[model samples]
Target: MDEKTCRFLPAWDPVLRFLHWWNAAAMTAMAATGIIFMVCGPDLPEGTEDALVSIHASVGFLFGAGVLARIIWLFIGTETARWTDMLPISAHHRKVFADTVRFYLRGFRGETPLYLAHNSFAGPVYLGFFVLAAVQVASGSSMLGLPEEIRSKSMAQELHATVFLLLLLYIIAHLVAVFIHEIAEKRGIVSAMIHGKKTFTDDERDSILEAHPLAQKGDFDERKD
Candidate 1:
């Protein structure tokens, strides 16, 4: 942790961070409302079901918009935020990905590969999340357009329910993964999403710079530098 051996870098852009928290809040609201309906069933008071549905639908729209914006950002955002970073298209990326898998397989022990933005192993997992988000949006939208009686038994409703379950599982897995990484790497990953910076050792910094010569560096903090 010597200042001379570690550095802080700007890893996430402002727009990307905003969308991340925006979707998080929206998803939390949607999940809360959805869980209430699942637990309450038909035993709820008079207009409670209708009120919950309205809240869920409103949150769904925000979540859908956030997902769409993120998809677009993957193409037009910063070098670290683009599809290039998300996919193992290059040799360096593929190598890092393999090392990452090995690290996880070994129970988060040993040397995990360093990444300035999304973890190479997590990139594809995130891609899957986006795909699920798209499906959820489509299914929910279709259900919204259907008649109440038909909506309950429709294919869209079934898909929506199934995807919601998958999403819950995904959330649990994502949190576990993040917890492991934060403990193992001690890289300020959780804070990176909020403040757009990550800490790296001097050797790690050099390796990343070699791989990404143009990687953006954040303003130096004398205490951290």
Candidate 2:
């Protein structure tokens, strides 16, 4: 491929990328503390459990704030980052969603549809994750507010645990998918999240730009002819 035929395109904005990694770190910390709590149970020293709980709560609060920031960005960010971009509201997008699913089902061996932002199928899943996170936050808050006598008996802890488990599974699946894409498509999916840019061939860039005109707003159109 000629050097001119490939160019770097802005994918994630700086704020969005920062929030992504911030939430990732927060969640990782929360997960680690949670696992320790689960494994140590009541056998640990007197203050160990309380200390773990404190760390978990602190990271959880940060994660919740990050989620809120992301939700606000959905409404105020660029077209690629907006809710409309992710949702399959049009017939064309719905068709693309179906095709993307079919491509995945076929073992992801071939070129799947290229999307400048999140794929049509992934939009709904991302939305679902947000909802789940909100629920987990609410339940955790409720658990913390309850009196000690009732806290253990309250359903909030169970609900929070369930949502956390679901979120963990989602995170695992998401990481696996990214890994597969890195190996199969080699589109720099992970690096794009880190550096806020993606490399694309001329044909790929043309197709993406045709589908998402707003993507050309930033450095996307800075390519040499």
Which candidate has the highest lDDT of all? 1
Q: List the residue pairs that clash in candidate 2.
A: none
* Model 1 TM-score, all chains together: 0.92
Q: What is the lDDT of residue 169 in candidate 1?
A: 89
Off by more than 4 A, model 1: 213-224
Tens digit of per-residue lDDT, candidate 2, span 1-225? 456666677778888889889988988998898888778866878698778888888888999999899889989987678888788885546766887888789988776767776778878888898889889878887776566679777788888888889999989988887887667755678998998777778887776666664664544644554
User: Candidate 1 lDDT, tens digit per residue, 1-225?
Assistant: 455666777888899999999998998999898988889857888588888888899899999999999999999998778878877777678888998989978888998778778777789889899999989988998788577789887999889989999988888999998999888888889998999888888778767767753363433332255
- lDDT score, candidate 1, position 62: 92
What CA RMSD would you report for each candidate? 2.4, 2.2
Residue 24 in model 1: lDDT? 86
For model 2 the TM-score comes to 0.91
Off by over 4 Å in 2: 1-4, 216-219
Worst 10 residues of 1 by lDDT: 214-223
TM-score, every prediction? 0.92, 0.91
